[model samples]
Every structure is written in C-alpha cells, then in structure tokens.
Target: MHILMVSHFFESHLGGIERVAGHLSRQMIAQGAELTWAASAQDRAPVDIPALALPCVNPTEKLTGLPMPIPGPGGMAALWRAVGRCDAVVVHDALYVTSILALVMARMRGRRVVLIQHIAGIPFASSVMRWVMGLANAMVTRPMLWAADRLVFISDTVRRDLIGDPARRDYALLFNGVDGEVFTHIGPAAQRLPEGKRRVLFVGRFVEKKGLSILRAAAAMRPDISFLLAGAGPIRPASWGLANVHDLGPQKPAQLAALYRSADCLLLPSVGEGYPLVIQEAMACGLPVICGAPTDRADPEAGQFLRGVPVDLSDPDGSAARVVAMLDAPCLTLPERAQMAAWAAGRYSWAAMARAIMGLMAG
Candidate 1:
C-alpha cells in the first residue's frame, strides 16, 4: 500500500503532531506500507524517509506563532500528482492549509482520506482570536472532517467536544504512541540541582499557548526554583533573562529522556491541548507532570499520575502562584514513578497506533 501523509511541519519543528507523524511513518514502513511524507520546507524531514518537502511561505507562523504553511503553485501541483498515485491519504489536522488542500485533492482523486484530528480548539488569551478560531473550526474544520472517508481523534476530549454524540459519527478514538525503549524509568532519579534547589522542566514550543508567559511569572515568583525550558519557538525563554530559567533548546528523544529522569517535575500549563506527547514521555521517564486540568484529564487512567490545575489566561500571575505551590509539594517516590512509567508504556505504543491506522486504510 502506498500512503501519503500531509502535515503542517516536519518532526524537526519539535511539535507533538509532527513527532507523531514521523513515528507513524516509520511504523507504517515496518508494516510493509510505502509511505511518502509531505510538509512545508520550513524544517528538515526525517533523514532516511521518502518525503516531498513542499515549497511554502510561513508568514503567519512568524507573526502569530500559529503554523500555516501555504504551498506555492509548483508544490501544489506536485501534491496533486502525489495524491493521484497514493492508495490512501492521512492528514494530521483539519486546521492547516496543507491538510485542507490534501483533503480536497484526495477527494478529487477518489483516494481514501483518514483525518487524524489532534485538537478541537485553542483557548487563545484574546477573545477576538478565540472567536476567530471558533469560526474557522465551524466553517472549515468541521466540513473537512465530515468530508474525509474516516475520522480518527487522538484525544477523547477532542472527540467528545467536536463530535458530542459518539453514535452520531463513525470515528476511532486513537491515542498517540510513546517510544518506551528510549523513555523508560532508569533506577531512582537523582536531583540535578544543588541540594536545596528544585529543578522544574518545561518541554515543548515556547509559544504563548504553551504557557511560557505563565511560566515566566512562576519563575519570577520563585527565583530559588530552577526552570529548564526545552524546545524552541518564537517566544525565546533565554530572553526572559531570569536567573532561575535555563533554556535547553530543541532536544531529541534520548536527550529529553535524560532531562525527564533528572528533573523534579514537568510543567505545561497550556490551554486547548490534547494529551501532549511530552507529558507521556515525561511519565514514561518516571517524572511527575503538572498541566492544564482539561489535558490532565484527557485520559482518565493516565490522569491518576498527573497533577491538574486550572489555567486562567487573564490572571497569569495567579496561575503562576498555583504552579509554584505544586512545585513546593513533595516529589514522587521511586516506586510511584515506576508505577507511572509502567502504566504509560503499557497503554500506548507506536506499533499499535500504526496497526489501527493501517486497518482503516485497508477498509
């Protein structure tokens, strides 16, 4: 089987969806399917995989931090041809131009299109922006979702929010997988900081929605606590110039696993997120996690291992104080960490995610 995957950016961007796409591509190949990945030329694709680096201009991403890659005429023509040859098309989300165009082209070519919707909505700080996003979802996203041959939601929260009635829509609730081999509990995790100082880790894009501002406030309130920020984006953590904040930049899985093992806890106070891959990776590495209440409860079973808190965009300082309180609390014990790792790895797998998607493609 030949499959074409369309995403806004590549795995090198350090976003969760792109990473999931890369994992699925490898798993599909291992399962005897020919996979061709196409994304914006903004970042590099997987080194050894077959890919079409579509020429695109990302002005929106530069200005607003939202990735919207618009392929040039030549790239669009190439994508049209690729759709004609592929047996099935798998799109990451319904929001991006690449995904929308892929849906249209796949439909025109009569190819089976599986829409893997990652997020339902983003609760932006701006009410105007929130309204705009809601309009986009209603006008564009829902239509594209309905037009696809099959729908797969990575988060049950997204599925429930978007398709309220489970029986009303034919969809699959598929969770993104984690690589347990790389992110596993070693023995007991030691404190990387000096004896009394605590290390708090935040892994993901440095964008506003990822709660960089709230984290900044939290770091200010508690100068004694160390804040290690991993992954890069328009919002530069180093520029914050806080003595307690350390920017580690983008990291690979192995490097991230190391950070998780040493860190006291993972902090992600972002809104409108599905269960982020970083949270799962942190849990797999036996690290405690503190994220938005909605996302922490994304998976009921996994929620047991997470610390959920309400995120108030209007009151970032108040939100920061709450995070500081969580930090001050006692850390997880070795046995509890081991239990968390066992549960996460046992439930999610890249191979299983691939198998389910392949089954949909086969149908």
Candidate 2:
C-alpha cells in the first residue's frame, strides 16, 4: 500500500509527535508499504522515506510547539498534487492546517483517511484561550471523525478521555515505543550524579502544561538530588532559578540513553499528553519514572508502568513532597531496572504500533 503521512514537522525538530511519526513511517516502509512524508519545507526525515517539504514559518509557540507549515494556496496545491497519487492518507494531527488540508484532499480524491491523534485536546495558558481551543476542537474534530475511514489514538487513556468509547468501530489504542537496545543500562546510575546526590532527569519541552514550574520548587526542596532538564522551548529550565538544576539542553537518542542509564530516575510532570515516548524511553533505559497522574490528563496507560510514582501536580507543595520522598527512597536495583525495561520492550515497539495502524487500513 502507498501511504502518505501528513506531519507538521519531521526532522530538525525534537518532539514526541515527530519522533513517533518518523518511527511509525519507517516501520510502515519496512512492512512493504511505500510511505512518503509531507512536512514543513525545512523538515527532513532521517530514514529512506521520501519527504515533501512545504513552505513553513516560525510562529509563536502555540498548538504543537514546533514550527508549523504555512499551508497557503501553494502549499495546499502541493499537498493536493502529492495526495493525488497516494493509496491512503495518514494524518498525524487533527488540528494543524496541513492535516485539515490532507483530510479534505483525501476526501475529494476518494482516498481512505486515517486520522492519528497524539493528544486529547489543545492546552492553553488562559481560560479564554482554553475555551476557544475546546470549541475549535469540537467544531473541527467532528467532521474529521465523520470523514476519516479510521481513527488511531496513541493511548487508551486519550481514547477514553477524548471520545468516551471505541464504539466508532474503526479505532485502536496503539501505544508508542522506545529503542531498548539503545536505551540500555550503563553500569551504576548513582555514579553519574554528584558525590552523594541522586540524579533526576526531565525530558520534555519547557512549556506551561509540562509542569516544569513545580520541578523548580521540588529541586529547591531537595538539594541533595541533581535535577537535569533535557529539552528546550519557550521557557528555559535554568531560568527558573534553581541552583541544583542543570540544563542539558536537547540530547540525541544515544546521549539521552546514556543520561537515562546514569540518572537515578526520570521525572516528567507534564499534563495533556497521550502517553509520552520519553516515559517509554526512560523505562527502556532502565530508569524508574516519576510522572503526573493522568486521572484528568490523557495517558492513563502510563499508570500501568512500574518503578515510579504518580503525583498530582495541582498542589505544588504536595507534589514536591512526593519527589522529595521518592528521592530519599532507594533507587531501582539492577534486577528491578531490567524488569522495567523488559516490560516496556515486550508490550510497545514501533513495528507493533505500525502494524496495528496498518491493520486499520481497508484491505
């Protein structure tokens, strides 16, 4: 089958959406499907899957955090030309302009459309903006849900929270994966930290909904633990004014794997996520994860993982106390770490996820 994947941005960017989309596309190609990617003109795919770069610009950090494609008349014309020849269209997002255009073009061409959503809804800073985005999601999502032949959600939590049930008869909760071979253990993790300090790693964009602000207070509360933030975005982690916090900027997979191996644990207090690849990656690297509970947030699948604690970020001091207590607790032993990695390896992987998505395609 010929699959055209519509992504807002591919390479030259570091985010869950880009990485998950790229990994799945490669797996699709490996599964005997001819996959072509349509993304921002500046973006490129790491693998052999061909990329069609459309005109894009650096706008404010809204929506996806990455730069968005300027799906102008020319861009839409380009997408139409590309879609005219594809067998099936898999759009990674339902909110982006490129995705909207891809869905419309696919419908017009009588092609099957599969819409993949990594998030339940758009998170905003203000209540007014949140309400506006909620309204937009409702208005836009309805048609796409009706038009698409099938829908793919990254996590069961998101599927339940966003649409209530899978009664639509054409949806699946295919979780993302991490490269266990790469995120392998590298000796003792305590050795990578300061003299007597435990290392706590946070890997995600420094955005509002990510809940990095709470990490600042937690770091100050527990100066014995070394906090390393491994991402870049609108808000710099070091700027939060925690002397114990170290900014590692953005790291490549190999470097990230080493960090995971050496770090005592992974901490991500983010909300509004459909399961994060970083969580899977940290687990694969054999690091226990301490993340936000997805009770109200998307990512309930995360609640199943071990070697971690789930804390509600609503109460700043309470959340900090959880981290403080966890820090004082013993880190995961080698056997426990191996068990954690194996659990993630056995259940989630790119090949498995791609096959599940492909299963949704009409034969």
Most accurate candidate by lDDT: 1
For model 2 the local lDDT of residue 119 reads 77
Candidate 2 Cα misplacement greater than 4 A, ranges: 44-47, 62-68, 122-125, 166-169, 186-191, 295-333
Q: Record all residue pairs in model 2 with backbone atoms less than 3 Å apart, i.e. clashing.
A: none
Residue 195's lDDT in candidate 1: 45
lDDT of 1 at 10: 94
10 residues in a row with least lDDT, candidate 1: 187-196
lDDT of 1 by residue, 1-363 (tens): 999988999999889999999999999999999999999988987887899999999887777778888999988998999899899999999999999999999989899999999898888888987998999999998898899999999888888878885545899988888898888987445447664577889999988789988999999999888999989999988888898998989887788888899988899999888889999889988899999878887787787889988887767999998988888787778899999999888998999999999999899
- The whole-model lDDT of each prediction reads 0.89, 0.75
* Distance from true location, Cα of 303 in model 1, Å: 1.3
Q: How high is each candidate's TM-score?
A: 0.96, 0.89
lDDT of 1: 0.89
Q: Which candidate has the top score in TM-score?
A: 1
